[model samples]
Target chain A: TQLLEQSPQFLSIQEGENLTVYCNSSSVFSSLQWYRQEPGEGPVLLVTVVTGGEVKKLKRLTFQFGDARKDSSLHITAAQPGDTGLYLCAGASEAAGNKLTFGGGTRVLVKP
Target chain B: EPEVTQTPSHQVTQMGQEVILRCVPISNHLYFYWYRQILGQKVEFLVSFYNNEISEKSEIFDDQFSVERPDGSNFTLKIRSTKLEDSAMYFCASSRDSGLQAFFGQGTRLTVV
Candidate 1:
């Protein structure tokens, strides 16, 4: 089974502090997606990385995909209270037939 | 923006009872998926549907679980016999094509007592 494991299941930080969450796996994927979920709601897509060693930035959040497609990371600069949520990483592979394998998620709490 | 929509934000059903979860995917999307997250657990894929048929399913999707696209816009998941373990937040997602960014609905919280 393809498994994506996220480190630091929970994180707490003061506002303006930076935080980084990592997703690692032994199985290679075709693409990796990052999502943030609020309590009682479904996950909202944040970014998707397809190319190896690619990096994308969205304002305060930066996403990086490993060259082997086996890992990814999300780095938040100057995290605000609004950035607090459950961050999840999911991997997609053609062999999986459109199904996404999700990580356990990292719950971040930014205190104001 | 176009997004997936799910009906009945919360559902409460008894064990062994039948429950059907409904979802309407984006009009332009062709692939639909069902995923669930047990409390404090990772989100797990249940099934993926395309072209009016099931493209893939996880082991969690057993005989009691079934998916159908009865119409052009509506996609539904039926649990013939619900169990307490089935209580979780069920999310519906859709994408324009395979391996693309899939948009998700707010989700339906299913509680099986």
Candidate 2:
């Protein structure tokens, strides 16, 4: 079983502050996706990183896939209250039939 | 934009009773999946369905759990018997393909007593 581990399980930061969430795994994946979920709701996909050493930016949010495709990261610039949510990283491995294995998740609370 | 929709936002049931959760995936999506998240836990994959049958399932999807795409647009998950541990937020998702991003429904919160 491939396991994804996230760092800083819980984070509380003031609005306008920057934060980075990390997702790491020992197994290689074909793709990595970041999702944000609020209470009482399902996760919303934020971004998908496919190629190794690839970086994609979505306005203030930047996502990166590691060179080995075994790790990924999300960096939020000037965080806002609206960004507060549970951030999850899921890895899809072709070896595992392209099934997704999600990380433990990071709870971010942006305080204004 | 199109989205996945789930029915019965919240369900409270007895431990031994059966429960059926429903979902309407995106009109054009071909892949469908069911996932659950116990409170304070990570989301866990249950099963994946396609071509009117199951394509994949996780260890958590045992004999008591089954999935059916009864109609062209509707997908359903049935739990033969509920257990206290079954209480969680059940989410239905769909994607155009296995490598694409999956769109998730709001989810059905199941509370078993």
Candidate 3:
């Protein structure tokens, strides 16, 4: 089984602060996706990183796929109160039969 | 914008009772998936359906669990006998294909009493 280890299970930051969440795995993946979810709701897809060493920016949120495709990271800059939510990373590998192994998730709270 | 829709936003069932969760994926999407998340836990993939059949399933999807695309637009997950551990938020999702981003429904909170 391909296990994903996430960092800093919980994070509390003041508004305008910056933070990063990491998703690491030893197995290579065809694609990696980042999602954000609020309480009592399903996850909403934030971004999908496919190619190695690729970086995509969605306004204040930046996502990067590692050079080996075994890892990814999400960076939020100048975080705002609206950024508070549970962030998740999912890796999809062909060997895993197109299955998604989600990380434990990071709970972020942006205090204003 | 279109989103996946699930029925019975919340369900409470007695232990050992059968239950079926329903979903209507985005109108044009082709691949369908069922996932569950225990409170405060990560989303777990249950099964994936396409072409009127199942394409993949997780270890959690055992014999007691089955998926059916009943018709042209709806996909359902049937649990023959729900256990207490089955209490969780069940989410239905769909993507144009594996290569696309999957959109998820609001989810059905299943509380087994």
Interface RMSD of each: 0.8, 1.0, 1.3
* Residue pairs in candidate 1 whose N, alpha carbon or C atoms collide under 3 angstroms: none
* lDDT measured at residue B105 in model 3 versus the true structure, 0 to 100: 96
Off by over 4 Å in 3: none
lDDT of each: 0.94, 0.94, 0.91
RMSDs, each prediction? Answer: 0.8, 0.9, 1.0
lDDT of 2 by residue, B6-111 (tens): 9999999999999999999999999999999999988999998888888889999999999998879899999988999999999999989885698899999999
Score chain B of each candidate by TM-score. Answer: 0.98, 0.98, 0.97
What digit string (tens of lDDT, one per residue) describes model 3 on residues B1-113? 99999998999999999999999999999889999999878888888887888888898999999988888888898998899999999999999867358888999999999
- TM-score against truth, every candidate: 0.98, 0.97, 0.97
Per prediction, fnat is 0.78, 0.62, 0.56
Error of 1 at A99 (Å): 0.8
For candidate 3, give the lDDT of residue B49: 81
Highest lDDT among the candidates is held by which one?
A: 1
Q: Which candidate ranks first by DockQ, i.e. highest?
A: 1
CAPRI classification of candidate 3 = medium
Ranking of models by lDDT: 1, 2, 3
- Candidate 2, chain A: TM-score? 0.98
